[model samples]
Target: MKSANDQATALLEFRLSAHRTLGPKERDLISHLSWRVEELPARQTFIHDGDKPAHSCLVLAGVVARTQYTAGGQRQILSVHIPGDMPDLQSLHIGRMDHDLETVSATQIAFIPHKDLNHLCAISQTLNATFWRESLIDAALHRAAIFRNAQLDADSRLAHFLCEMHFRHKAVGLVDEEGFSFPLSQELMGEVLGLTIVSINRSSQTLRSLDLIRMQKGHIQVLDVDGLVRFGQFDGTFLHQRFDHETLARAS
Candidate 1:
């Protein structure tokens, strides 16, 4: 039987494996932190707009949505959060939240206090670097979204989003040739793409007809990887893979 310490160590390893540059000391710090596991039901709100956030959450399972509401009560979905993602790290440092984070499925999250995270970073340079990398990736995604909105057509935007999600999922070991389970509905996708549901459905159908992607239930499969890449105009450089020798060379 695995001891409690051993189990905790394994969990930390699993969680931190996505950070290719994380070392043993950082992993040890992560394991030492007490984590509160909470189950978030589908459509439940984790962070509300204008609310002072208390703790930063690390997603363990299921999907979370970061959204914003308009003055007229319209809601826009900004992004979707997956496992191994920390959705509100920016709020922790800023002291106030600008958007809402809600669960789109029955989700599990590990809650870490902001103070605890700060203390951990003070003690571990490796942990600090990991956090910095995560923040940079988040900012890069936002920048990509802004650029896509400016330059891409609705069809191209949808394709790019799907391709980006597929690549990110694969990086975190959550995807295969048949894409990972995406718990988003058409309405949610529409909000993210700034399209109507009718438009999203039409675009999805178009992709299916072209044999680039297939969706069954909640699962998506990239039927033709090369075709999808070409259609999406995707370049994987935005993913910021720390362990990639090419990426390291570029950084240097």
Candidate 2:
């Protein structure tokens, strides 16, 4: 079992990423949530499609991918979730899972039972609303991903994904002067962006050749922030970030 301090730190990260602020009561409620931690290896599929999950999975470490497979066995990645994300929170309301949730890297996750979450929401309106807002944001991100896949060229699509991850990692205090850890490999990037491996390679090469980004040793460093943003056609407004666009831009 992880110590209380570790759990508290994880909850704080979630609050910081989910909302700008939390009342003492809300924080207290979150602290009281009971969870069991699990360490799983990379490429592991813990939650299968159509499973009625009893707990919501909070990412304590590494990234999680929400994916679905077509009848012909082609995979489409719906979203990439990072630390502090309660990726299965929607399971509290929506009983059955529509897609599989898998780890992209060796991952540590805290599983909070649905019974506890339902009870907590029963008493706290603000906390309930906060969670509801988070689910809405999740939906918005999916829509954005769909738009990018349908409308943007391969290079621009990849650029947009890079910018989005940079902003999100920055918000959660995961970014540094050298940039943040991006766990997605080129093959995985192909899965997420709905492109072939060859196309993904071409797009990645294009971005690097243009001096917009550097991806080395599983980390991305933004060399030209403005150029990347313009190329990606990225706008942080839809992210519903607590910080303004300028703050996120400057941080990158």
Quick one: best TM-score, which candidate? Answer: 2
Candidate 2, which ten residues in sequence have the lowest lDDT sum?
243-252
- Local distance difference test, each candidate: 0.77, 0.82
Candidate 2 C-alpha lDDT tens digits along 101-196: 999999888887899888878888877778888888888888889888898999999999998898877766677789889888888899999988
Largest lDDT belongs to which candidate? 2
Q: Residue 156: error of model 1 in Å?
A: 0.9
Error of 1 at 113 (Å): 0.9
lDDT of 2: 0.82
Assess every candidate by TM-score.
0.89, 0.92
Clashes of 2: 0
Q: Candidate 1's residue-wise lDDT over 1-252, tens digit each?
A: 844344334444554454664677776677787777887799999788888877887787789989998889878888888876788988768888889999999998877788888998799877776787787888888887887777888788888888888877665567765577988888789988888989989999989999989876778888877788888887778877643222211221
Clashing pairs in 1: none
| Deviation of model 1 at 249, angstroms | 29
